[model samples]
Target: MKFGYRIIFIVSVVIFFLNCAYYYPFFSDDSLISLRYTQRFIEGKGLNWNDGHPVEGYSNLFWILCTAILGKSGLDLIWAARILGLACSVGTIAVILNCFRKLHVKKEYVFFATLLFVTTPCISVWAIGGLEQPLYGFLLTLVLTEVLYIITSKSFRRIYLLSVWLGLLALTRPDGFLFTIITAGFLLFTYRQTKTNLLTITLAVVCIPTLFLLSQLAFRYTYYGELVPNTALVKVKITFHHILHGAFYTLSSFLGTFVLSFLGLYSLFILVIRKKDLFGFYLLLNIAAWISYITLVGGDIFPAYRHYYVVLIFFIFSIILGLKLNLPNWVHNKLQAGIAILIVINVFLQYNIPQNHRAVEERWEFKGMNLGSTLKNTFPDKTLIAVTAAGCIPYASELPTVDMMGLNDYYIPRHPPANFGTGILAHELGDADYVMTRNPDIVIFDVGNTPSFYIGEQLKKNKTFTKNFIKVTASDRDADYILFFNTYGNSTGIKRTDSELTIPGYLFRNNEDNAVLFTKKKLLKKMSINNRYEIILNDIPSKNWKIKNVLGKNLEVDTEIYQKNGQLTIIMIPKKELLLESLVLEGKD
Candidate 1:
């Protein structure tokens, strides 16, 4: 293929990955929290600091940059952040392609290397998500690419460019400091023979990232009280055992998520076996150091692969260089074919599978309820509604909601305030003329447990004090629980009730050893057991109770139970060895 077509192909692959990113929801928790912070910052709130102390738990530079470009409100901010990530991803790919071209590597090698970096599941997935990893990876790769140029051309301009990229990289992720250290070491060691070039690269490299870190530290001290954030301290306290576990996890993650990551390493191994040169040695050392750093950080291993993808790209470039200079045509062709097949499979999986749709699924399940519509349709527009689920409520309902979560530190005043649970709930409920508690309102307790007497007592007190209280939805099926609206207060005229019951589900568990149980909660009293009746118990049922089917943990049963003298009993003997928690009597109205 022509060099121009290869370049176009690379660019197309990058764009295709960026396009694929749109289908996945913003799955990163840190990204979501950062978005919330960005919204707050744009509203004039300062950086997060604890108790008037300067601490750096999080740096909102990327989010600020995103909000500045995307504007506040709507889902546009997510797209904008993703676009910025895509730009970095595309730039990283371009750097790799250019480096291969400059190195006089074979076109096939360049294409394979570029394909490895672009289509690797780990890199591609994160390139589209709103996170700093892809951007960090890109900047790191660009710095390395610039280093390659500086070494080849000995240009003062390349040195300066390297310094700028290093600075931006540090600003992107704190780990960029390692890149600065390693690069400085490499320059000093190699170019000691040329003092001028050595000093220029060393000074520029040291000052760039150092200045960024110091400025961030200053900001931290001013706002949060410490050089490093409390969050970092908390993370750093894990045991060495956890670190080892994390390393293994990181390895498994590479295998599972980025299938080509291991393949790229295998290709590097092949290159090393063929030609063990200084470049190959450096590639191995870089990979080892990068992997060590990731394992030491003990971060989410899968995500860390995404964060350090630039290192993978660097390795790919080295492999291409090695292959072109040493490997035979037959060997190179076979490797290229294997890599192409891997890329095709990865791309197919990316398109066909909804791997990252969990975020959207959560949002739809939890946030799609029309709080405002539910309220306006049932009550007056002016009626005040207090909700414990504050974030979703405000977005879904047009009416003002007292956020029990204390998000943004908004709460109603109270004297001799209640505990964290009731105090917050009271703060929300006190000013409200109406209260809406969705399924499992108590939060700590579900329908299986008896309702809290204190809650009912408090409601009774409030009702007596105000001489006005009415439960709108009281039936078990009406709403799982009741919504209280004031009959005498300002909310007197408004009335609303939801007939639909959001069925609360519970996971089945078996406390018995070596047994599995599966059952739903709140089963009916009288039920006919037929072949379709599946009973999953911790222990196997008695021989008397025929097991029609034994499929994995589930046991299908066919039995008859008839009420006798106001008592219900099954004819089959209860298994003495079978331990039971609670029986779920199903199929009864």
Candidate 2:
């Protein structure tokens, strides 16, 4: 419980060990998108994804910019990013300890909660996953610390500093703006309590954030030519389904992993039931802002639950703050034991979960390494390359690329597919026609993938696409060797599974069946005018298969030994023989 360097070192060591525990360490693929931007900046490419266009493809700008600056020194970027993530996460623990001491919480209680936080594997998850979560966590916890100071002691300087932190938080993640606004509003409204004037208090609270926001807007308009980051548009559907996913994302990521999440939620409810104070009310406002923001964005796509990381960190600190002021002695004794048991169970789960496998779920980040190399070797000319997921491939390859779903594109995100709703992820589907019109030499559908991105689906069917690009994997003759991760076999040859057939642009697969799927209703209109659309078959049908409409209505099908110029015809050969390979739709467009 003592605030000593030894305790700090112990907590720090525990953090590092637990972070490296679940499995052999691996960074996230999404993190690489920002790294790609950093590398571009390092290369003097003027911070653009493409040569001339400066699009804000990434959400974590300050992190990318920070690393980009470090990248200029030819630093070991992998180590740098990971190390920074660790530092920020560790810093959150230290700040928590300090805040508890400042609020006069029992030293033992502070140490206990802080220990639980340090050992929580989810804390370590982001520590090594290589993203802005740790930094965001640190900034937010620090805000809570200042929020405590502002509410308890009425420090003038802390109020302004809180504004600066709030601004920096927003700049770090796009959704952070919600926190900034809510905090600023709380401070202004509570001016009477602070014993400061509205004018003085407003300046104290809003000055730093206002300037930071203005500077951000000016730079965005001048460089990226957009007021909002491109990712803001890319990851948005904002439907009721999104709210449902948001709830699932938080529960599954936080409560599913960190046992303390239940404690944190319960603590909030208890606080609401008990007497309300300035600090408690402020915490509630911030929590509401953040939760709504997360719901609006449709939750995180990355594993290990990133979106709520900082919120949980802040929430835990606030819980400690409230408990210090109010819990009974008997309740305190029980919580102590409860936390100890939770810590053990939490560690056990961290060690046993599917996350430890490092293959099926955690393999994406490791794949980025070889995938990037393969992309580079495949596209030796450094021409235009399009990818659904842009981070890992573009970052590792260090090549000129297009973010097809529009995170980095100027056009595609603005014009998404007709009916784009994945309901889980929140990115816009790229315009298939536009990507084709741009004519990327090698288009990839890995990054930011979704059903709507089936503009990617339609792209493969487009005559121009099939004519220009070929389905080339990283292990293809067109690419270099790809060493799979530990569990995967040593050989680079990966056989295509049945699931591979469903992938949009896979090679040596059924082009027609997987290409442009037309249901019975659309099929009628899809037929060319005044002629039967006769698709060449590779073989005959073995079973009865009829075209179905989008609404699942079966259509009346009629066929014959249809033949075009010189193609072989087998419609009349026999029944119970071959698999269906083609279709003959007789109708007018």
The candidate maximizing TM-score is 2
For model 1, what is the alpha-carbon lDDT of residue 422? 23
Off by over 4 Å in 2: 1-9, 21-24, 193-195, 330-336, 349-360, 377-379, 422-428, 447-453, 472-589
Q: Model 1 segments beyond 4 Å from truth?
A: 2-7, 18-23, 49-63, 72-75, 257-259, 270-279, 301-305, 308-311, 330-339, 345-589
Score candidate 1 by TM-score against the native. 0.60
Worst 10 residues of 2 by lDDT: 484-493
**Deviation of model 1 at 87, angstroms:** 2.1
User: TM-score for every candidate vs. truth?
Assistant: 0.60, 0.76
Worst 10 residues of 1 by lDDT: 499-508
